[model samples]
Target chain A: MTHRTIKPAPNIVQGTPLDAKALKRGKIFLNSYAPALRYTWDTGEAMGRYLAELKNGRLIARSCRKCERVMIPPRMFCERCFRPTDDWVYVKATGTVNTFSLCYVSWDVRRLKQPEIPAVIEIDGASPGMGILHLVRKVAPKDVRIGMRVAAVWKPPAQRTGSITDIAYWMPINRRSQRTVSAK
Target chain B: MNERVAIIGVGVMAARPSSEHLSFKEMMFEAAQKAYADAGIDAHEVESFVTCAEDLTEGISIFDEYTPDQLGAVQKPMHTLTQDGLYGIADAVMQLRSGLVGLVVVEAHSKHSNLENPNSILNYALDPVYNRPLDFNPHVIAGLEMNGFLHATGITQAQCAQVVAKNRTHALKNIAAAYPMNLRAEDVQSSPYLCYPLRDAEMAKSADGCVVVVLAGASRAQPSKSRPVWIRGVGFTNDSPTLESRDWIDAQYIRAAAAMAYGQAGIKDPVAEIDLFEVDDAYAYKELQHLVALGIYPQAVAAGRAVENGESGAAGKMPVNVSGGSLGIGHTLEASGLYRLAEIVCQLRGEAGPRQLPRAKVGLAQSWRGVPTTSGAVVILGR
Candidate 1:
């Protein structure tokens, strides 16, 4: 049986569009309220250990005996293997950039005077492809590149706290040597 | 497989940047009323109801409580998915195919205009311990992924711009689209960069709208006023939420979701079997990335060339986002997938007045829950 085409009825959609100015000027009746919600997250066993090691100028990862993959921002279990992770592995404070972004806007969409370089650094001694998100600094934003080696810049021991911020930022390493080799 | 499901009715409120005159409930009521009328049935006939929304976005606790009244779903089996509308459709399809519900209704909406700071809300979606401390815009994730994807697949920045040019131009013919325009690849390339490699024009602006769809079992669907758009297959998947473990370059979530849908539909070759597609275009690069993941194009470079050559255009071999996609229609958050599904239904039923495709028998709709997450859903529809 051939069914005839079914068209939507006329004026089916009903909604009035308004601009930000009109909404602010009270051109339309409105009610506004802001909810203040607070949260306190518990950094679990693996993450707690990871953050603690960061304060001491070190990086730690958990290894899965089944997959033999060392993961950062350590988790208690291996998702792929569906088993509890086997051991804690200490990784180097230096690594290569897996990917990077030069952000020109703030979280609220406002343009920034200085672009922030956010990157995923694959830490040394961990399995390949395992990386953590962090900021890249101490170099021009344009100079940051994927696969470039970088070392962690840590805060003073007196100021150190159990947090990811214990390490100030990641900075490019062997820049002079890299430039000389490229020039050769 | 024992019973088939079909979409009997679809109703939508045309997307706009803001809808100050109507509350979310009013928007829901309007959409539901039109859908019921289109199906030639009343709300009471629907045995199950599913609404897609996030509590943070709605600014209300237990958002589903507000849904039942507007949809006339009071005292009915109703729940909310905190995911996109495509997931809601998948849920309804399962219910109908289970032989428990003869009729079902799925609804989703976006009141993004009400948000004073959407970025702040999106920030809460990040991992508190690992990612949230960075204090940067969540879209930087898109920027990072775009960089990785381009480097891995050899797709250029100019090719990404062509996506914006084609999708926006297509929106010019869609009355429901909010940001329709005639743009060139050069225009997008010259636009200010929000994040390096991700220009401001590349991202979709949020819009306010609601979509309500009425679905029924094979027996119940035959009596509807509108021609039934059969749900041949439905699939949804979520990859790792952690930034450390997930694949940054490839959209494995979309790949798995599409694989499940294709398998159920018995589709061997999606490029030839599907007539048209309305996939997610939350960002210009995402359209190309998703095309690669959908297996429609072999890789990002091939997808880019297809866009440049207009092979994905309205008249191309495989028409993609002919309804302007989220880029042109304005991203409707959770309602995005339903909007895409409604457009496909209109085309398959031959009711898409101006932007209709000729001999469109099969179509697909896909959606991704945007940034700071890896979750998506896919649905295939046939006439």
Candidate 2:
């Protein structure tokens, strides 16, 4: 039996002939039956709920039930022990910048966009090794490097909301004693 | 021991830029039917089907929508892999190894001519977080890899052009080949640069076509309708998705894949063991880089001597791209592997009219998924 081939009309109504072949600017129908992918934040819920605490100017982490290892960003499951986590410990908002890349492009291609530097920082008061992916502000793209000490600059208490973006990118925290000592 | 699968038949639809007369399914069925006819097996004879396909967003909705039934795969265990065509072939090899199924059909189609912006469509394959944000044209990744390949291997631009000239020359013998032209180093050099160090002429022209092959277990009674090319071995691998992460100097994925496949095929030296090759030259420079990865081209100014030996033609050392490869036959993405499979099977059967190789016993075909993911596969076919 012969299968009838399906062809759709040209999608791009305007454009110069692409090649010397003199072919019409057209569309082909692709029939895909693969199962669709659906995802839920099964593990991200604790991180989301803990991050919800940040709106009130508080940091929280989950302590592993078996290993007693602290997980930042409060995940529901512990990676090391392979067990569920329940201990919600509050911590301070001080951490060091782990690594970062200065991005100069935007998702939208139409407009000329400014440089945006997205960085991954390890939050203070959370587990020493735990890290979060966010942005860094008030620093030259070139000046950004690994191990740069930065502190979270939260919004006013009443204005605080449970979100990473609420911190408005970490700022360089200057140590006066270290600066003066280095000067001597 | 599980039964070894043998490709009992192979067929390819004539590749073209735009098949105004045929739909993608029609084109696929054309090749599938021809393969069934060649194998003397009806669609009902096959136990399952595997097709290589991408999202409908590339064309219209229902991507695997028109396959199966159209390819005569109705009511069987059919599955479509959203991967490169050759990977789908690798999947078939796995299915046959399980011993649950004896016969399987693998089909891949390319209707590139349908896309408005092929580059934009290609960008979707990149890491959404980093590479895609920069909106890197997929060719740039190849361009970067080619630069590293040339610098590390010392294969010169001229050698790259020679690869093109030889492949196109061999393609001239392929009736189904769409871009069979007698090219010269100067001709390729003069073509505009799509990306630095890569010329427009060097790139494989995208086309619309279908290629399908019918493979059955070796333990099954021989059909005798057509000679079978046993699947000696199959190898496929994917490299780091981030271009920044890998040592671009070598196509580690291709080398690793080749080793696994060559080992399984009991081939210690591909240059000596493989009688002919069907290299996936999506871009002319890719042939040089991939040859190096396959451990064939070892220098900057590679003695593309093997390519120019006239062996890849009708009679001439280890003919490569005798069906013209993607360079001459046009790269149909998913269908390209089947095209390579068809040529190898035909050559081994002494059925490649005018393009047949002399005393060809073994065939090797290698393909790389274009970019973002430096993924590739290598397969060795034996009679």
Candidate 3:
């Protein structure tokens, strides 16, 4: 048989579209409440250590002896092998871009004057595909690629805080780049 | 099993971009009233009720406290599922199969326009130390996953655009579809990018909506307004919640969920057995990746050929997202899966109008929890 009953129109339109003028007038406003909820998260044993190393200008990772997978932003246990990490390892500060996005807007939906190149950089010492979500800098947004090599541009030691932002942002290793002394 | 669950009636309402006409409670009431009336049953006959919603999406903590009043489910054996509406239906199926309840109603709704800061709200859902400090837009992860999925599957961005063109054009036939643009693959490519690879046009914009489905046991299936579509299989699973730890190539959770559902339905081959699919295509690339994950295509590489050859279209060999999907219709947060499920039920009952299939006996609906999480659900239904 051919089709019989077609479903009705999609939306349930009732009142007219509320314009900004009437909305701002607050004539029909019944209640007003702004939410402010706070939370305190324990960094746990693994992430707590990872943040401490970031504060000291180093990248930390953990290895699972069972499956031999190295993890960045280190974890206490291995997800696949189902075992606690067997060793602690420090991954290289420099890595390749696993993927990236040229964001024209901020998290709060505000358009940015300059687009931000946010990429997931796969740490050299971690597993082959494992990566961390962070920002890229010192390169034009158009020049960024999937496998581009980049190094972390850290904040000065005096200005460092125990946070992911301590690494300032990542910069592409261009031909004219100068070498910096390692933190021992 | 003793008996199968039946979906007798479904009610849904969605507005494009946003809905300024009605409040969230009013939206739920609209769907609830239609659903109950369609099922030829009243609110008093409903033994239990299941509502799907989340605290963060609604912006009001303990959101369920405000749900029951509108649905007329007050003081009954009512419960809530924080996940998608598919999960609520799955739970309701178990409740009815236990021979306890004769009638059950599952409800879910979305009010994203009211959210003050949706991005920050999503960021709060992320890990506090590693993810939040980067101040990343959640769409960036979708881009990253799109990269990994395509690189692993050898699917091109142009092919992904075909999915956008296919769905948006497919929406023209669906009256319920939200953003029905007359777009093509070139148009999708020419569109400005949202977060690299994932163009602003490809990602489904959130809209305000509600969905309610009435499920009655086979014994009580009589005295009904419409034919009951039996729930043949139901499955949902969780992969590693952390994106860093998951198999980023494809959705293992989807594979597992499909296996469970297909197993229950005695479906050895999905592409051959299932007539059509109504998956959560919140993003364009997701349709390609999910087809591979659901085992419709043997691997990700096979998806491109199918899409490019018009094999995944409404009249194609394997029709997918015929109700325009979330990309065509809007994604209604937790209610998305049920919205798709309702489409399948409508198609099986010969009620889908211009978008209906030639002959559909069995259909599948799949959904995934949005960004930074690897959890999904699947359900199968037939006439």
Candidate 4:
């Protein structure tokens, strides 16, 4: 292909410096210019309350009033229903791998120099369908298949927090024996 | 009442990834000016606004903060779609269809060069649960799709390379195209692999640019200085973002969108009805996948009948990617769709110098969001 050679026009405008060098320092400086953002959340609170249930080996979701659909990672409202959820429902922690990818790069070439395989898994239990975003470990990326059963692996009780990361990762659930290990 | 919506203006900036001089807003403003001038309308005349943006952490601190001032949309009804250019057009169309707004200005641009982890930012678009954890570069997904396309359709790598060569040749006439080079199939095949089966030349380089279009109602669409290419029909649909759940080889989302648009335009045979086409060739296989999906190429063509008959060019049945597409041009996110749209307008108005398809009366434009997501839109325009 013959690439177009662009000639810079004399009338082109300029802007404020992006501080390219300082950005490469990899450390925060005092009084560095950055934009401030303010956020509020009924959703955050719902997630907090829901994450609390996961530690006790339970999965919860919000059921919408208008559409009567359940939202995983429990939001206060349902997008499809366009209405507030009517009730909180508990779903099984087990699910199937919906889709996944094996990531080969790291941020700043940091820790875990090895790649990670991420996926979207649809949880099993409750109204027949709902998936949540989380990491899957203990199995090679190529060995994984869609619809393979998996279960949540929770962190130790002392390290528990009201967050999605509270579950260390999802491990392959042994369907042949229906065996699951309790939280570490 | 029938909706009278039309695109009354268009604008774009000279494309590049690391523009040393201008800010994102400056690039947008320059493009907006050209669109407004083409529409023969002032910025104040626009009743609503829809702008496309992505993560602010990628470049600016707040993503939406840079939109209003740049688009001249101060105090106007505006919404941000952190998606491709087609999404912005879809929003404007919906607002116009509701009889809620008459004149809407849509803006979309990308300034991705400043980000340190640009590849990671693209990966973030994947489903964080399964897809992102794998550390998969989204380009690999394109490879898989292309592999499937080749395996199923019997299309060779050389044929795919021909697409690149043809598109770049078409783009040589386009003033705004960033990488308009005369390339050969052998050269493209021998290039370094970004992802298996997809070489360096096959991928569209990240370029920073702005594209804006003024969409207006019927009365405002009356031709002034430049002919207004009417948007006859618009179609958009999204497939399961979960990649494993869908057929990666087939572009169902684009097919569905194209069906809706072609149906609305009363087009039963796209090959015969459409004159020119601008497909989302964000990846090499996408153009062929979309072509097959739209039924522009049927099973017989899939079996190599079309190539043997000397009917492979877009002008053979329907000329595709006449503006050289995102492949020859550049995929500046939201800017890409409007760039396709502008090319169609220019073609219909006989303004395209070398790329002007003879007797072009109608055109189709399509776009696909890159990876883990399959959101797409198709629009049919008429002179």
lDDT of 3 by residue, B146-254 (tens): 8888888899999989888888788888877677777889998998998887888889878777899999888877635558998999999999878677787888888
Task: For residues A136-183, write the lDDT of model 1, one tens digit per residue.
Answer: 887888778899998787887777898888877878887654221110
Cα deviation at A157, candidate 2, in Å, is: 67
Per-candidate clashes, comma-separated: 0, 19, 0, 32
Deviation in Å, model 3, residue B6 alpha carbon: 0.6
Question: Which residue pairs in model 3 clash with each other?
Answer: none
* TM-score of every model versus the real structure: 0.68, 0.65, 0.67, 0.65
Q: Residue by residue across B1-383, what tens digits does model 1's lDDT show? A: 45899999998999999886666766777788889888988777789999999988888889888788668787889999999999999999988888998999999999888877788888778776677777788899999999999999999899999999999999999998999999999999999999989999999999989999999999888844558999998889998868787798888899999999999999999998999999999999999998898898765689989999998998888889998998899999999999999999999999988888886999999999999778999999999
lDDT of 2 by residue, B1-383 (tens): 36787888777888887775555655666787788888878777788888888863345445665576566666678888887777878888888888889888888887777666667667667666556667556788777877777777666777777777877777898888888998887888888888878778888888778888888888763847557788888999987767667877777888899988988888878878888878778888777667767876545344455555554444666567778888889888878777887888888888888877776899888888776667889988988
Residue B53 deviation, candidate 4, in Å?
A: 1.3
Question: Weakest 10 consecutive residues, lDDT, candidate 1 chain B?
Answer: B20-29
True contacts recovered per prediction: 0.00, 0.00, 0.00, 0.00
Q: CA lDDT, every prediction? A: 0.87, 0.74, 0.82, 0.74
How well is each residue in B1-383 modelled by candidate 4, as lDDT tens digits? Answer: 35756777788786765664555655666788788888888777789988877754235445676577656677778777877787788788778878878889888886755555666666656666666667767788888878777887787777777777767766787778887888776777888887878777887777778889888767667776547778888889988767777786778898889888887889988888888878888777677777788788767236234432335454565577778788778877767787788788778888888767787899888888776568888888887
- The DockQ-derived docking category for candidate 4 is incorrect
lDDT of 4 at A33: 23
- Rate residue B289 of model 4 by lDDT: 77
Q: What ranges in model 1 sit over 4 Å off?
A: A1-184
CAPRI class assigned to model 3: incorrect
Tell me the interface RMSD of every candidate, in Å. Answer: 19.4, 21.7, 20.1, 17.8
